[model samples]
Target: MNFETVAPNAVPEGAPLIDVREQNEWDAGHAATAQHLPASTLMENLDQLPETDDPLYIVCRSGGRSFQVAQWLNGNGFEAINVAGGMDMWFESGLPIVSDGEGEAYVL
Candidate 1:
């Protein structure tokens, strides 16, 4: 699978930053602008992915899940980018994480 590393600020304005982590981890912290769509739900929700030309940035607490999701997207013809550091890397970089809001939904 094709994969590129995307730094925290590299995300485009108004782009969908997909968080592929579990619910509890997401509740603890995540990119403020990221949308929760765990890896397990990715294939089932391919229709919701952003346009093919735009980035479908996938992230996880660490890097494992995002890699899987990235591979899946790439295999399916989407340009998938992996947030190399994921949430842990983001936190280590001193970036901020937002609380889960009403619009947030967790994957099983």
Candidate 2:
């Protein structure tokens, strides 16, 4: 019930950025540092997520999918926050984006 949208800059270093969009959508654009863990695959790879209970930023092209993923992550054990407005906002705000093979995809 304490869902909060983290500011782009507030995103800490080395925290996992969960991208819940489909592969095609992700290939078009995404936060460069975000991980390609589509929501469909999240439940299967929860073990790969960082152990910290802090908060992993869940994002998508829009807010819908990311919101669902965020809720599920909340029920799991890790603290998850949805990036409000999702990738649209991140891009509109002039934050960096990574297209298919255009830039770095992982932070660590």
Candidate 3:
């Protein structure tokens, strides 16, 4: 399966941002506009995926899980790309994140 991989800053504005991290990580912090679809629950919720010709952006704590998800989505006919440095890099790059709990938002 072939798919593109790009850094956090390179993800297109308003592209479907899929957060493949688990709930705990998501609760800690995630891109303000990201959709949480933890890799573990992805298959069951595949129907919820957005419809778009533009590439779907997948992110995890680091890059591993997102890479796997991007491959899977690509195999399933969606144009998906792995966010190369994942949430860590996104946070480091000063991107906005949302936190459900107390304290400063952090990439988990």
For every candidate in turn, the CA RMSD to the true structure comes to: 4.2, 4.2, 1.0
Note the Cα lDDT for every prediction shown.
0.75, 0.76, 0.92
Error of 1 at 4 (Å): 1.1
Look at candidate 1 and give me any clashing residue pairs: none
Q: Candidate 3's residue-wise lDDT over 1-108, tens digit each?
A: 567899999988998999999999999999999999989999999988888788899999889999999998899888899999899999999889999789988988
Where does the lowest 10-residue lDDT sum fall in candidate 2? 99-108
Per-residue lDDT tens digits for candidate 2, residues 9-108, read: 5667777888888887888788878888888887788877766656888888767788888887787665888887778777777788777856554221
Summarize candidate 1's per-residue lDDT along 24-105 as a digit string, tens digits: 7787678778888877776787777666568788889777789788877888778888888678777777776776655443
Stretches of candidate 1 above 4 Å error? 101-108
Whose TM-score is higher: candidate 1's or candidate 3's?
3
List the lowest-lDDT window of 10 residues for candidate 1: 99-108
Q: Output the lDDT of residue 60, model 3.
A: 98
Candidate 3: pairs in clash:
none
Cα deviation at 3, candidate 3, in Å, is: 1.7
Taking all chains together, the TM-score of candidate 1 against the true structure is: 0.80
In angstroms, give how far residue 35 of model 3 lies from its true place: 0.4
